[model samples]
Target: MYEASDLKKGIKIELEGEPYIITDFEFSKPGKGQAIYRVRMKNLLTGYSIDKSYRSNDKFQPANVSNLKLQYSYFDGTNYVFMDPETFENYSVNADLMEDKKDYLMENMEVDGTLYNEMVIDVTLPSFVEMKVMRSDPGVKGDTATNATKPATMETGLEIKVPLFVNEGDVIRIDTRTGEYLARVSTK
Candidate 1:
């Protein structure tokens, strides 16, 4: 259980039997009213967000959430499959649930799966990933007049802008959180 005073960003709590993670929190004590906690939370199961307010005396149940280390197995047309490295148990998540995350998933890649009530709700990838550029146009000579960039397709099929000097068959580091190019690693 958690008191209103305990509510803060990243704290998980149970509401109506559903798990929610606080994404934003603000406490306000007006000149004459009771202290109120304004919070914005995301539903772990549905990927929905809501804003709520509570008084200082309110209490909430703690959500049952756990993180499991799983490895990406494969994507079956309609769903993405993951397997527990140790137990070899398979978990399939709907493709809709993965959204843009599917762009960064790589076979055999290890990731953290967030479970709510023993059911997988979300997956977290590494902050940075190394990917090979599958296609990129050659940069024109003297194009270094500024910080120029060109579109490159990654092996995963994710398209991103890379510096002008980047070419096809090059390996580069990418920041997964922002889907941005970091630096060139090697040329193949």
Candidate 2:
């Protein structure tokens, strides 16, 4: 059990019999009233989010989540498959559950999978991923003067606006959170 005042980002707890992860939290102490906590929580299983407030003394039971380090094996066309490094057991997750993570995941990449009561709830891909550009237009010779960007497709079929200097066949770093291009990675 934990008090509302102890809530922090990444903390998991149960509310209304559903497991949720605290994405952001703020503690507010009213000058003349009671202390309250405002939290933005996302459903661990469904990916839904809501803003809720709790009194300082409100107690909650921490949700039990099993986090495992898994290796991306291969996709079965419909679902992406991952294997537990420890047990060598494989698990397949639906594409909808993977959402934005699909852009960053490559063959043999390592990712973290969250399980609620042993049921896979979510998968977190790396913050930054290296992917090769599969398609892009030619850059203008003097386009480097301004902060211009051109759309490029990565090997995973994800399109992102990369700098004008980028070209097809170039390996670039991508920011997974915003699905933006970071920079070109040196082949050397």
Best by TM-score: 1
RMSD of each: 2.3, 3.6
lDDT of 1: 0.92
What are the models' TM-scores? Answer: 0.85, 0.76
lDDT, candidate 2, equals: 0.87
Report clash pairs, candidate 1. Answer: none
Q: Ten residues in a row with the worst lDDT in model 2? A: 179-188
What lDDT does each candidate get? 0.92, 0.87
- lDDT by residue (tens digit), candidate 2, 61-103: 9998879998999889999899998999888888888876787
Best by lDDT: 1
- On residues 105-183, what C-alpha lDDT tens digit does candidate 1 reach at each position? 9999999999887677899999999999999989888876677888999999999999988888999999999999999
Error of 1 at 121 (Å): 1.4
